[model samples]
Target chain A: MKYLLYCIFFSWGFSLFSQNKEVLYGLDETPQALLLNPGARISNSFHIGIPLISHLHFNGGSSGVSAYDIFQKSSVDINTRIINTISELDDRDFFTTTQQLEILNFGWKNKKEFYFSGGLYQEFDFVFYFPKDLAVLAWEGNANYIGKKFDLGEINTRGDLLMVYHLGATKRWNKKLTIGARAKIYSSLLSFSSTDNSGTFETRISESGNNIYEHLISNINLSLNTSGIASLNDLEGGSATNKILSRAFFSGNIGVGVDLGATYEINEKWTASASFIDLGAIFHTKDVESYAINGEYTLDGIELLFPPIGSGNSAPPYYDDLIDEIEESFSLDSIYNSYSQMRPLKAYASLKYNFGRPVGGDEGCDCLNTGENQKYNQSVGVQFFNMFRPKGPQFAATLFYYRKISDYLTFKTTYTADSYSYNNIGLGLVANIKILNFYIVANNLQWYSNFAKAKSVSLQMGLNIIIDENK
Target chain B: MKKNLYLLFLFTFIAFLFSACVKDTDFNQTDDIALTTVLELDFIFFNINSQNFTDLGINNTIVSDTTDLDFLDSEIVSENIIRADFYFRNTNSFPVSFLAQYQFLNDNNEIKYEVIVPVQAGNNIDPVITEFTEIIENNALVNFTMATKVVVNTIATSSLNNINGNLDLQSKATYYLRIEE
Candidate 1:
C-alpha cells in the first residue's frame, strides 16, 4: 500500500501543466519546433532525440487566487484569509495542468526534401473549475443564507492520462508554402469527467405547511463517467501497478487523431503559419462506469395530522414517509456503458517579418541549406493561441522577438496576455555544439522573485542530436 | 568561446532562480483552522381538534397524546453540536389551557433532559397564540445529545368534550456546531 501511494504521489508531482509550446514555435535550430507546428522549417538534415529527455514540458496555472494568498504570514487569521479568498473567486475561475514527456523521437530528411518524424510520448491533463456556490454552502451552510439557491451547476472537472504514438511528414509543396500532417494513435490509461450539471438547493419559508420553513432540492441533473478505475479497487498493490503500466501500451482504450499545419511565405520578409492539434475522440469501453442523478425533492418538515374527535386511529408514519420520498427522489445507480470523449483541441497561428543582417554577414543564401529561405538572423512576430476546455475556449496572445546570437546560440523573448495574467514575460534559448542540440524555455519570469504569488507558469526543455547538410 | 560564455551565463542564472525563487510561507497555519456553522431544522408539528379530548362522548379533562421523535439522537447531531435552541409556537382555540412536555430519554428510558411549555386558555372565537424558547448549552448540551428518543406530551387543563375549537403546534431547532482541524 505504501509503495502504491508513493508511486501515485510521484506520478502526480511529475505531471504538471499546459500543452502550449509558445517559445518553441518557429524556432529553426532544434527539431522540437516540429512538435508545435510540423510545417515549421528546420535547418538540419537529420535529428534524433535523447530518449525520455527530448521534450519535457510542464504547464499549469489558476485563473484565480494563488497559494500565497492563503498561506502568507499575516496578522489576520488564516481562516479569514481563506474565507476572503473564497469570496473573491468566481465560478469561471479554473485551474488547469498538462504535462508531457517524449520517450522516443527521431527524424530524417530525405533526398526529395521531405522531413519525416515519428515518436511516442506520454501526457497527463487535468482541469477543475472553481464551484463558488458549493464552497459557500459547505463553509457557511444554509442557515445564514435563507432563500438563496446554491447553484450545483458550478461543478465541472475533467482529467486524463494517456500515451500517444505519432508519425508525421513535412513537405515544401512549393517555393512559397510548406504543409505537414501527423497521424496519432492514443492509448488512454485512466479517465474521469463530470461536467454540464444543473441543480439548486434552497431553504425558504413555507407558504402552506405544518412547519415554518421548507428545504428544497430541485431540477437536479448530475453525472460522472470514468474508465479504468473501478477495476483497480479489486486488485492488490503490485497487480494495480502492473495493470496501469500494461494499459500504458496499446492495450487500453484506444483513439486516433491527426494534426495539420502550414507555413506560407508571401514575400521575401513576410511569413505566416498555423497549426491545429488533437482533433479526435477516445472510445472508452473496458472498465467503464457511469453514475447519474436527476430529479427534484422537497421537505417541509414531518406533519403529524391527528385524528378528529372520537376517531380511533394513530398518526400516520410521517418520518418514514419523508425518508421514503427522499430515497426515491435521489436514487443513484452505477451504469456500465461505453462512451466517447473528444480530446481538448488546440490551435496556434502567427505572423512574422524577418529582418536584420543574414547569417554569414548578409552573404548569399547558404547553398546547402534546403529549408525555408535561410537568409535572416532576426525576426519579430505576434502569435495567437486558443485551447478548447470543458467550459469554453481559452485564448492567449504573444508578441515575440527572436535573434540568432551566434552560429551555435539562439535567443527569443516574448510578452504574453492570457486569462491567468496580462504581464507574462517569457524567454527561450537554443544552442548547438557540433551535432549536439539543447534548448530551454520558460515563461512568467517575473514570478521567479516569488513563485508562490504567480497565478500560472510554464517551462520546457530538451536535448537532441542533429546532423546538418554541410556535415 | 563567446557561445560557451553565454551558455555559462544562462546556466548560472537558472541555478540562481531555483535557489531563491519562493518567499517564506507558513503552512503550519492549518493547525489553527476552525470552522463554525449554524443549521436550523424543523423538528415536530401537529394539529388536533376538541374531539381528541373526549372518550366515549364523555367530557374529560387532562387528556394527553405522546409521539416518538428521534432526530436529535443522530450521531452527527451528538458529535458536532455545541449549542442548541428549540423554538415552539402554539395556537389554541380550546376553552381550556394546555401543557406540552418534551421528554428526552436515554437508552434505559431515563429522562436526561425535559422541556415544558404552558399555554393559556382561549375562546373559540379568538384563538390565543403563545411562543416558548429553550436554549441548551455547556454540560446540559452534552447531556441532551445522549438522548436516544424524544417524547412529546400534549395535555389539556380542563374538559373539552364539547369545545368546538382546534389546537395547533409548530416547532424548530437550531444547532450551532464547532469543527476544528
Candidate 2:
C-alpha cells in the first residue's frame, strides 16, 4: 500500500493547472493588456516596461473541491471528510496553476497608423487531472473484493517551464479598423507529462494450490515523458547552472507560435474585437527520456524455504529465483525519443458600447472622430475567452463595466463565469502620473474574505514609463 | 490631483496582495477508510453427473464447480491490497478434505489472486471451520471464481449424484482518500 501510494505521487509526475485570465483581457488600461489583444488602441506614443517589475502574475484555482472540503473545522473526522469529498469528485474536475514574469518589454508608435512592440517573458504552466481509482487502491488494502480491475488510464497530467520571446506590429487603417499580429519563439527549460495510460491490476484466490490468493498485474502499458529534468535530476549527470541558464533563449528544443487580433469600430458607440494567441507547438527531441511498462505478471504467494547450509555445499539463489521469474514475466523499457506538444492556444472576442465625451467635437468636425485623443468617459462590454487545455477547451464569459474617472485615472470591474467559479468578480485600475504609469488587477475578490473556502484566485500588476504624443 | 494619483496606486497594490491565491492545497492525501463484506458460497445445486461419478472401473475421480463472486463497489479501488481475511469450514463427513479456492482474474484472463482453504481430516468427521487473514499482493479486483473440488479416498464402487456441503467467507476492505481545504 505504501509503495503504491508513493507511485500515485510519482505517477502524478504531471501538473494539474490551466491558464484562465478573464478579468485582465481587453482592459486596454495597461501596456501588458495588449498581450491579450494587440489591436487594442493606446493613446500613448511609446512605453517602456521597468524590467522585472514590469509585469508579474500569479494565479491558481481548483475545481470539484476546495480548501473547505479538507481543512474546515467540522464535526466529522479528517479522513471521513476527505473520503466524502473524493466521492463527489469526478475526472472532469481539475486543478490549475500559472505564473508568468516579463523581463523585457517596450512599445513605440513609429507613425500615427503603425506601432511596434516586443519582449521576453519566462512562464511556468502546469495542468493535470486526479486519477481517483488509482488513488483509492493505493490507500486501501485490496482485501474484501476478491476480484476487481483498477484502471490505469486514470493517470492524465502535463507540466512545463518555458521562456518566450515575441515581437508584434499593429496597423490602424482608420478609426474603424485596427489589426495586429505577434510572432513568438518558445524555449522549453524543463517538462514532464504522462497522460493516456492503460491497463489494470487485480487479485484472486487460487482454485487449487498450496498458496493463498494470487495477485496479478496485467496488460500494463503506461508511459512517462520528460525533458531537461532527467539530466539535471541525475546526481552524476553533470549539468552546470551557467550552461543551463545560457540555453534559456534559442535552445535546441524550441517552438514557434503567433498571435493575431483585430478591433473594428462599427459606429461612435459600438465596437467589436477578437484575438488568437500561441497557435503553434514545440518539439522535444533533445535531452528527452521516456519510461514505459508493457507486460503482465502474477504471484501465488510462493514462500521460498532456505535449509541450513551443510559443509561442502553451495548457497542457493533464493532471491535470484524471484527476480528471474518477475523479469521473465514483465518488461520495463526506457528510451529517448522526440515528442511534440501544441502551445495552449488562447482566444478572446468582445463587443462594447462606449458612452461619454466624443473626440474632436469641440473642433466643429463632428464628421471625423478618429484621432490620437479619442476619450470615452464610460463603457460597457461582454467578452468571451477560450484556451486549449490538455483535457479540452476551457471557456470563460465576462460582462464588464469601465469608467474614466479623470484624465489620468480609469477603473474597470467584471463579472465572469468559467469552469472554476460562476460568481467571479474582478477589479482593475490604471493610474497615470507624469510619464510613470502603473496598473493592478485582481480576480475572485469574494474569496479574499475566506481564503480557506476559495477555489480560485488571480492578481497581476505592473509599472511602465509612457509618453503620450497627444498630451 | 497629484496626491490622489499616488493614493490610488497605493490602494490598488495593497488590495492585490490580500486576495492573491497563495495557499497550497494537497490532493487525495488522507488515509483512513476501511470496509469489509462477506462472500457466502452455498452448494445449492451440486449434482454429480456420470462424468464425475462413473463406476466404469475408475480408481478415482475429482468433481468441482466454480461460481462467480460479486463485488458491488462503484468507485474503482487499487490493487495495493493491504490484506485479506479468510474464514471457512467443512460441514461434511466425506473423509477426504474439501478443497476450496478463490480465483481472481482480470479482463486479460490473467490470474491475480489464487487463495485456497485446507480443511484437515480428523478421526471423527468434525464440522470444524478455520479463519485467517493474509496480506494480499494484488492491488485491484475485477472478478473472481470460487471453486470446490472433492478428492475421493475410497475405491469407486457406485456412482451417486447430489454432493452437499456449506462454506462461508467474510472479508474486510479498507481504502484511503483525501479531503483538501
Candidate 3:
C-alpha cells in the first residue's frame, strides 16, 4: 500500500514536471511528440527525451438497485421419521442487490521514447449496495411455534483500484508531420461484503390432570450475509519482501496502441497538429470464491417415543449430501467469468496553435526583438478524447499565459475546461530556472450539470537538467 | 496575445469561483420519522401478593373478596392459572388496522393453537384484547414464567413478550405474538 501510494504521488509530481505548453494554459489543441513539446521538438535534435507525466480524472453518477421476492411456495411432505430424525427447519430465503459507483482517478506517467512509458494510477471509488429484506418463517416441528420475520442485512463496501501501463514511440516523418503510437495495459479490482442475523421463536403448552404437559414449540431463525472481494492479501500487506509474488499475479496483461501525429507550420506564428493514441484491449486472470449457510433439527425424546411413532434416532441419509449440494451450487466462478470478458480501451485527438517568436531570434516577432524584452507569450488549444471505451466524448480548451518576472524567474498559469455538460476544470503553475523545474497542477475542480464531483489534484517538484549535445 | 490569455484566465477563474460558490438549495428533505413494523414482546409477571396492583377499570376488577393466587410460593397449593392477554389499538388518528394472532408452543413440539385478532380501520384510542386464554395446570412450570421480558413498539402497534427462551427455563413456555397489516 505504501509503495503504491509512493508510486502514485511520484507519478503525479512527474506529470507536473512534464507540463506541455498547451495543457498548461489550455491553449494547445493538438498532440505533440510523446515526450517533448511541439515547439521544443523543433528546437531540440533527435536527442532522446524522457518525460514523466501524471493525470487526475474523476467521475460521479447516480445508479439504483432492484429486488425480487425469492419465496418459492413448496408443499413439503411431513414424514414422522424425517421430522423426528432431522428437525424440520425452514428453507433459507433469497435476496438480490444492486449498487452504484462514484469514481476518481489519480495517475503518474514516465515516458522513455522507443522504450516504454509505464504508469501507476489510483482509482478511488465509492459503491453502495442495498439489499431488501424478505419475509420468511421457519418451522420448529411444533404447532405453537409459527412466527413472522424478515431479513435486515445491507452491503456497504468502498475503495477500489484501476492501474495501467503504456509503451509507444514518436517518429518524425518530416518537419511538417510527426507520428507517434502508444500501447496501454490496464485492470480494475472491486469488492464488498455484509452479514445480518435476526428472527423470532415461540412455544406453547397445555395443562392436563394437575400437570402442564408440553404441547408445541416453533423456532424461526433469520440470518443475512454480504461481502466484497478486494486485491489478494499480498497487495493488502505493505511488505517489500512480498513484492515479487504479489506483482506477478497482480499484473494483468499488455495491450498495443499507436499514436499518429502531424505538425503543420501554417505560418510563422501558427502551428497545428493532431494525433490518435491508445487504441487496444487488456485482459485479467480469473479468480473466484463463495459463501453460504444452512440449518437442521434432530428428534426430541417426546416426539421419538410418543404420537409421532416409528421415527427413529438416526441422521437423515441425505443431510450431508444436501449441504454439499448447496456449497457447490453457490460458487461465484460464473459471475467472475462474465466480468473477465470486458476490456479497457481509450482514444483521443487534439489541435493547438502557438503565437510567439522563436527563442534567441530577431526575425520571428517584434516582442522578442530585444535581448532584455521581458514580455510573456500566450497560446490557446482544444482537445477531444473518449474515456472508458465509447462511454462519452470529452472536450476541453486551454489558455496558456507565461511571463518572465525576472532574468531567473518566470511565472505560468493555465486554465482548461471540458464540455459544458461535464464541466471539468484544470489549473497548473510552473517555476522554471537553470537548476530546477518545480510545478503544481490540479484537475476536476467543479461539478458540471453532467458530472458528479471533483476528481483529483496533483502537486510535483523535480530538477530540470538541460544537457547540450556537444557536452 | 499574453494580455488576451490573461483575460481568458481571469474570466475562467471568475467563472469557476462563481460555479464553486453556487449553493445547492434543492435538497431532499426527510423528517426524522421512524417507520417501525416489528413489535418484540417480553414476558409479563403477575404478582399475587404485591400491593402495587391497580384496577384501571379496563380488565375485570378484582373484588376484595376474590382469592389471591401466588404460584411462586411452594406452601400455597393453589392452581397455577397462567392467562396471557394481548391488547390491540390503532394509534394513528386515521383508522389503521391489522390482522393479529398469538402462537403458543413448547420446545421441539407441535403448535398448540392459533388465535386470530381482527382489527378495525380508523378505530383509534381503543384497546382490544386479542387473547384471554388461561393455561391449565400440570404443576409443571409455564415456559413464559421462566423466560425474559421484552417490550416492542411498532408504527401500527406495541407488543409485550413475557417468555424469553434465551436461558434455561425451569418451567417456561414459548409464545409468539405477530400482527400484519
Better of 1 and 2 by TM-score: 1
Q: Give all candidate RMSDs, comma-separated.
A: 3.7, 9.9, 18.8
The number of the candidate with the highest TM-score is 1
The two-chain DockQ for each candidate, comma-separated, is: 0.47, 0.07, 0.03
Query: Which 10 successive residues of model 3 chain B have the least lDDT summed?
Result: B162-171
- Higher-lDDT candidate among 2 and 3? 2
Which ten-residue region of model 2 chain A has the weakest summed lDDT? A8-17
Model 3 interface DockQ = 0.03
Q: Who is ahead in lDDT, 1 or 2? A: 1
lDDT of 1 by residue, A134-199 (tens): 887766677898889999999999999999999999988897898988889999999999987999
For each prediction, how big is the interface RMSD? 4.9, 13.2, 20.2
Instruction: Measure candidate 3: CA RMSD.
Output: 18.8
Winner by TM-score between candidate 3 and candidate 2? 2
What residue runs in model 2 are displaced by over 4 Å at the alpha carbon? Answer: A1-17, A141-149, A202-218, A235-243, A297-329, A357-375, B1-16, B19-84, B87-94, B97-181
Tens digit of per-residue lDDT, candidate 2, span A1-471:
423433433222222223655666766657887788888776667889999989888777676666656655555765566567666777667766788899999999884657788999988887767666665554343554467777777787888888899999888867689889999999988888887688887767655332445567788889999887766764443455554566697774798999899888888688888999899888898889999878887765323222223335533443356557988876788889899888889999999888766544354533322235344567799999898876778888899988766556667889988887788888887777778888877777776665546567677888999887766
Query: Which lDDT tens digits does candidate 2 get at residues B119-160?
Result: 442223354444444334234332322212111111112222
